[model samples]
Target: MNIQLNQLIPIPLKEKILQGSSDIWNNNVVISKGDYLKIVAPSGTGKTTLTHILWKLRTDYTGEVQYDGCNINGINAQVMASFRQQKLSVIFQDLRLFGHLTAIENIELSRIKSATPGVGAHEVLEMAETLGVSHILNQKANTCSYGEQQRVAIIRSLVQPFEILVMDEPFSHLDENNTLKAAGLIEKVCKQNNAGFVLMDLDEDSYFEYTHSLKL
Candidate 1:
């Protein structure tokens, strides 16, 4: 699948935020399948907001956001929801886990409305173990450390099938070694699935060999 943005600009930002080098805030771009892309910007730059818009969580932004050549804004809410469930997965900055539930339970609640087969609980546990958080899976999400919760969020996002995975500061809580581990896991899975990824971060450095980089 390919996402084409044609002069897509976030509204209410023309007067507030200063423009960047390529005018990405008000310009055009393409995110193709198998593309590994990064969005690097400082705080308050709408990195999270952009991801939300891509996944239909927000409608305040202006201009066209096309999914596989179809105008996303033209679709009804039901169809949009279906599109996200089947084709998009996201690791939100806030983690968005059910804090009262066990990590495994929280991970298991991922939307599996896609045509592809859903991941089993054992596979979810394996992903947690790979990220070094298997033991914590039985614990309540709120009781786990921030890093452990982040790993839980990663597992939750990965268990579903997707064409595009959006990560908003996904490794903010991890050290270099753990960050490398998480990135490697994402790379391996994305390659296997032939899915593209869009990662938003604070700096230019990235663990994956990115196909493209842009500033907000």
Candidate 2:
């Protein structure tokens, strides 16, 4: 599967984006399977908007976003839900975990939501251990630190099946060491699933051996 952006430009951001140069806005770009892509976006750019567009959470944009040649906007609700369950996953910049839920519960919710079988509870535990978040597995998400919640969100995103994982500033809360640990886990998971990912961030890093690095 591939995500092809055909001259995508957000409606609300049209005037501002038109005044600038970007490889993603108002341009055609293809993100093929197994391609690790890094999008370097400075502040005031539509980095989060691009992530939302790819995830089908935002439609206030011109042009087309296609999945395997089918325009995403044309995908019906039920089928689009299925696509999200089995093919597409995302980690938002906000680390959208349930505040009332335990860290493990948050991750388990995503794991069980998949139409296809995904990581089991034990595997989730292993992932938590790898990310140094195992200690907070039983803690309420609201009480965890930002870095801990971010790691939990990362685990949540990986517990499901996905052909392409779209991430927006997934490591903004973590230190360099934790960021690298999370990246290593993401790389391992992508390779295991033969999956690809598009990571949008503020600056460039030597993360995941990116196949394409673009400015947004």
Candidate 3:
């Protein structure tokens, strides 16, 4: 139940915005154990870039990012991939699903690749059901509506064994009702798993239930 951003991976920010001279991002934001961190920011505020840096996807950034009190930069690519598969789960705003794969297959594929225990088809299906995606379990990911796909993505993260869940603009594609529904579902799952969650969204009013927040 320990998470840390050590001295390596400094996570410094310059005047780089999506488009601006001023620094939209400040210093590094750390997620402690069992914390649900909601990052509130404007559209082009570099929230996703911060997330990518944290996940080690964009290592060219100026600072260090650590996890579990260890400097992630010291890990090799294979070790980093292993750490990511074992400890981190990310949900992109666009719902990055394999179009040709079934909803369940998308979840199962991650299980197979990572060999993460306890994430079988049945478990994934149950998670999808809890997220109101049972009926579309066998459907192609590309065929489902945006809300359904988003739910599927959430289910994928939930069933996998991960310590951290990173979501970027998770509620952007949903309507009012589905947005509320999805947020509730995500909250329930995170609490049940005792996992840390970092959600980046401009919808400040949407996530008031979060325990804590980090504003960029």
Query: Whose lDDT is higher: candidate 1's or candidate 3's?
Result: 1
Candidate 3 regions off by >4 Å?
Answer: 1-13, 16-24, 116-120, 206-208
- Whole-model lDDT values for every prediction: 0.82, 0.92, 0.70
TM-scores across all candidates? 0.92, 0.97, 0.82
Query: Please, what are the lDDT tens digits per residue for candidate 1 over residues 86-138?
Result: 77788999999999999988877783446563466677767887899989888
lDDT by residue for model 3 (1-216), tens = 344543222234444442343222434456865777787877766677767777777776554666766777787889878766777778887778999999988877676667755356676666666667899989999999988888888777666667778888877767777667777766776676677787888857645467787666
Give candidate 3's whole-model lDDT: 0.70
For candidate 3, the 10 contiguous residues with the lowest summed lDDT are 17-26
Can you tell me which runs of candidate 2 are displaced by over 4 Å? Answer: none
lDDT of 2 by residue, 47-89 (tens): 8889889988899999999999999988999889888888888
Weakest 10 consecutive residues, lDDT, candidate 1?
14-23
Better of 2 and 3 by lDDT: 2
**Clashes, model 3:** 8
All predictions: root-mean-square deviation over Cα?
Answer: 1.8, 1.0, 3.6
